[model samples]
Target: MPLEIAIAGGGVGGMAAAIALQNQGHNVTIFEQARAFGRIGADVNLTPNAVHALDGLGIGDRLRATAARPEFRISRTWDSGEETSRLPMSAAAEVKYGAPQLTIHRADLLAALESALLPDTLHFGARVAGVSQTEDGVTLTFADGSTGDYDLVIGADGIHSAIRHALYGADDPQFTGLVSYRGVFVRGEAPDLPNLDSFTKWWGPTSDLQIVTFPLNRGEEVFVFATTGQKDWTEEGWTLSGDIDELRDIYKDFHPEARALLDACTEVTRSALHVRAPMPRWSEGRVVLLGDAAHPMVPFMAQGACMASEDAVVLGCALEGVEAEGLPAALERFAESRIPRTTRVQEGSLANDWLKKGGNADWVYGYDAWGALKYEVV
Candidate 1:
């Protein structure tokens, strides 16, 4: 039986959930606080684990067409430029995981997801102030004193989710005491740096300064991310005006490869790192948390979005059938499975960067999301 499903937040995770549920013939709607659909981030990577989930949404080919597939994964020292770790990316990724790792602008991925949904599936400027749960379903109270009810509500509203606060109350996120500069530059404008067709990262001796570079838009542009220590992060949100001079000076003594990538960035942005404590309960009655709202991981694994994408796929699979009679149990099972799966990711991401042990990530990159979602309810 088809059900009325409501999702709070229209981010990548929310959109992914929308696509997954909509494919199930459910009436899926997204309530976004913003007036329009836009993605705010540097760029995103879809390791093979996430690529499989994208294929399930039927946008695999479209994403591939617009994204860059790094032929290899390379890591180097921050200053000396000594090659520290390497992994095969293109052919080897496909052979081992059945999907190619992809990197693309956040906007491009959002646009593709926007096109996949049905007409008017998204309701922008719908600010949800609070939620109320009844015996049958969930009711959302908007900031405008309006309310809407649905058979189920998904809190894809991201880390600062109001829905989560309404359920559990006052879960403040702690800053990780790191500030990073990020940007995207046209390939033509770059210094013709090496690893243009690869995912290359540079690390400081003590994990104090780090830089990650990769191509996007089929090598038409390069994505640059540089992390350094900053004690005071009095700002809120993911984007702040970045000082190019200050950023460039920080990595001045570093290898030319990293310097070249940083110099090409015309518009630099920075964000203070913050993360939330894992929730012991991901669901309450008809309301459930997904993505960052549930387990906002550090970017070490670059699985923040990837885990959310996996959550949607798994949630959809768990709620595959049986309708209202089975909804509660199915949701519990979904949360149960994800708590451990995503907790490991959350903890590991917090412990160190995924490449900390010289990039031996078979367990992280080689996992199959498509097969995991096919699990039968016990």
Candidate 2:
């Protein structure tokens, strides 16, 4: 039977889940706290694993049309400008993993997922305040003092998820002692910058300090992701206005090419990095968690969003054609299939040793979410 589902937080994970579930004939709706979607976030890397899942959701062509296909992933020393590693990407990744790797503006990626969802499926300014599950249904209380009932509730509300907190007790995220500065600029603005054609990173003296640059929107723009050690951060949000001069000062010793990229930026945002240990379980009764709500990790491996994409597809498969009475078991199955893989990714990301010197990434990029759930008995 097609179940009535409610997704809290209409982010990439929530929208992707709505698309996948709607494709399976379920009735779904997304309640987002924001009034409207804006051109927020810098750039996101959709490695083959995430691309394959989006392909199954029927938006592969839409994304590929606008996303930059980097030919290589290059790494260099912080100050010497000497190349340390180069990994083949673009066509090579597609040939090896069955899907092309893409670097796109985060807004564009969200637009692609939003375009696939049905009309009247999204409600804005509906912040989830609390969630309670009955024997057969779940009720969601919004910030406006309104309430709604559904057969199942998915908490895609990010790391500080209200749903997860309502289900389990408070679990504060520990700061990773790293602060990131992100910015995006037109490619033409940095005409003389070296290595703009590839995804490049200049390694700092320590693992926690580095600057990564990649092209987005068919190579028309470049995005910068720079991180450095910080002792304390009291900010409560992710996209606070960053001080460009302070950013440049932190990376003052970097190679001229890297400094050039930062010099080209007109604006930037800063955020402190934080992570939580993986939960013992993701689902409680009829309400389940997804994305950062279930397993928030450092962004070292660039798998944060990809793991959410994978979770969406697997959750859709786990619930297809299931009756109300069996929903809990289906959700349990979804968690079982996803926890081990996401947990491994969470731990790996914390270590921050991915592809620093051109190591094998097959284990991370070669996963097929659709294939993994194809043979499972629901």
Best by lDDT: 2
Counted clashes in each candidate structure: 0, 0
> Clashing residue pairs in candidate 2, if any?
none
lDDT of 1 by residue, 218-317 (tens): 9888888888888887987667889998988988888887788888888788888788877778888888899999999777677887898888888888
Error of 1 at 367 (Å): 2.3
Model 2 lDDT tens row, 1-378: 789999999988999999999998899999999999888765798889999999999999899989999888888989898888898888998999988779998888988999999999998989999999889799999998999999999999999999999999898999999989999889999798777878888888888779998888899989899998889989877689999999899889888898998999998998999999988899988899999989998877888889999999999988878888998999999998999999999999899767777788888899999877778775
Task: Identify the runs in model 2 with alpha carbons over 4 angstroms from their true place.
Answer: 375-378
Q: How accurate is candidate 1 locally (lDDT)?
A: 0.84
Every candidate's lDDT: 0.84, 0.90
